[model samples]
Target: MRNNGAVHGAFRSAAMRFFSPRALAAPYVVWMAAFVVAPIVFVVIYAFTAGDGAFTVGNFAEMGRFVGVFARSFWLALISTAVCLALGYPAAYILARESGRVQRAAVVLIMLPMWMNFLLRTYAWMSILERNGLLNRLLGALGIAPLDIIYTPAAVVIGMVYNFLPFMVLPIYSVIAKIDRSLIEAAADLGAAPRAVFTRVIAPLSLPGVLSGVTMVFVPAVSTFVISKLLGGGKEILLGDLIEMQFRGAAYNPRLGSAISLVMMVIVIVFMYFMNRFGEGEEGVAIL
Candidate 1:
């Protein structure tokens, strides 16, 4: 009886240890299992299975038909990311050098549009880019011919840059702001020119933030359907729109949609892998 009592005591001790304070992660683990992991599993299953439930690779084979879509999506996304980087780096650098009051005001201005509904902001851009819209109207007032700017790839890229530019700026600014001023001073004391100090000291230190911003801007830009739909006038058929059609439109092929989603996810993962490899030593901030 004493031996049996000791065995029960050991079991109870083990159970108590398992349910200790650190076990607060149980709810989060359960949530991730149910939401993130389970959805990925379902997507994989559906991607490989046909309507009749037989496993097949036909879904992936159909992806060949979307070559142009894949190309266009990546091209537009690349352009948007490039533009954001070009514009954001300068803005972030300048913002980092400003007084705290100026920095706060600038950040507020940058983020103001984001506080509004995303669809509403896109609609506002549509209004501004319309043939007789605000932009053209302003040009007419200046006696310049109204440019053909609306319902084109340019409009789509514009919408993307306007929306995602903040993501690029904030990360780079965070990194640039946190950089050790002593390094810049040291570079200056060593007789490095202002431009040289920036190129050699500041830019290298901020690469991780740049990488983070690139990933953030590129991922959403590649898969955005609403921007292409509203701004491209439904003419620009991207991978996002194609997948959405498969699932929601008359096409109604969830298997194909899942396959496309899986492929896109793989592509993104591979892209991120390369980005991380390029910024290997700076992994701490680069992946985010």
Candidate 2:
């Protein structure tokens, strides 16, 4: 009887420990350490060291040589993010007010494009944009001049906007869909005009979604190498291309690549900080 009692107590203790809150959180903690924390730590260590295993800051000094690359990437990403916001907001607003069937169709249309291989999607543009390709041939059929667009910065911008627009749309749609109909009704009951209703209530409520969308679109757009490479045709090297070259291209400087990665990460963090800081105002999206 004593032995059975002790066994029962031991089993209960194990069960209690296993069911603890900390136990449930352990997997998440391990995942965080393995993926997030470990990667950053490795980047930091590699970024601050030279090939000979000595500490150095020369990697950063070398990065200064590619200032134009950084600037170009930043400008391209900013423009793409802005364009996505312009195109996505109206689409999302319309979708938010749509019937269930229409809304699902719209969502499916947006996501369907993403289901294909990313490279294949980008390359498909090449066929449409290339000289004497479908677009040019279509223009020829209409007696319109065939325009040169492929392998240009404009092409790069188009790729960025096309690929990232859904990121902007989905977030805004989610926010607008959740907005209480009564709030809008209340605004209308106040004798406010449609423009006034939007400016006062709808826009402000959607600010967070816009901010999230911008971050989602901007980060990947800024870091994109494939889009710029295929579209820009290596004529213009952006920061991503630059960083990639450091590690894989002739330079083969992993330390420099790490430093640039670190700097880019810091820039993203700082930019997000300011965006979040500005967004925290109660008057967010509230026009004075």
Candidate 3:
């Protein structure tokens, strides 16, 4: 009976370790609540309230302007994401396939820009793209008229693409590096064309990375104020600018800003949901 009791006690202890709530998780939960959930709750409450003393629907009623801002934000983010994918895929492929030393160098080169302040990077683009900037000087030397690239929508896109490209490439490289060479070789051995192998094997297997990169690029691009302000100028006001305007200006309308913020959050959630659903069934295919 003592032997049986000892065995039962050992099993119980093991089960408790597996099933009991982890102490480590408690800190993370508290942190999330403090930083994320608390702010969101505050935003939600303010969104329902009004600038005036009374509770009102005025903020929600003015949501049309917010919707327009949201649309512009979405389109710019989409364009930036497309550019990141177009540029990052090849760069990631090369980095992943390169030798260890070359890969390390490439990674360092890719991440070097991130060490600089984001605002400084945006300002650098502004300087380069400005009418009397280095680019125009080069153009003049070549007997060409200086083109206006700064303070335009195209410039905004370019700035966003440059800044976020690393975010896209690193995730993709991580996925591609883990892909097995033999799976790719098998596809080739089976008489599959290069295009066929990439589409059927590489594309599907690399999807998780692509999704991660897309989310990383898209979310920040949509909400970024610095790039829009620096590159787009005041002429191209994005949703972030509008939110800032409400908060900082004499309006001081927290309710309206909160409503706009909530709407932006919803849009992000919906976009991610659809993207995940689209990539769901074809996961775990050979990628190398």
Q: lDDT of each structure?
A: 0.93, 0.90, 0.87
lDDT of 1 by residue, 27-58 (tens): 99999999999999999999999899999999
Each prediction's TM-score versus the true structure: 0.91, 0.92, 0.87
Clashes of each: 0, 0, 0
Write one digit per residue (lDDT tens) for candidate 2, span 56-117. 88878888778988999999999999999999999999999999999999899998999998
Off by over 4 Å in 2: 19-31, 281-288
Q: Decide which is better by lDDT, 2 or 3.
A: 2
Would you list the clashing residue pairs of candidate 1?
A: none
Relative to the true structure, candidate 1 has a C-alpha RMSD (angstroms) of 3.0
Candidate No. with top lDDT:
1
Off by over 4 Å in 3: 1-21, 24-27, 52-55, 282-288
Which is the winner by lDDT between candidate 1 and candidate 2? 1
Q: If ranked by TM-score, best first, what sequence of candidates would result? A: 2, 1, 3
Model 1 segments beyond 4 Å from truth? 1-21, 286-288
Cα-based lDDT at residue 281, candidate 1: 89
Give the Å error, residue 100, model 1.
1.9
Question: How far is 5's C-alpha from truth in model 3 (Å)?
Answer: 23
TM-score of 3: 0.87
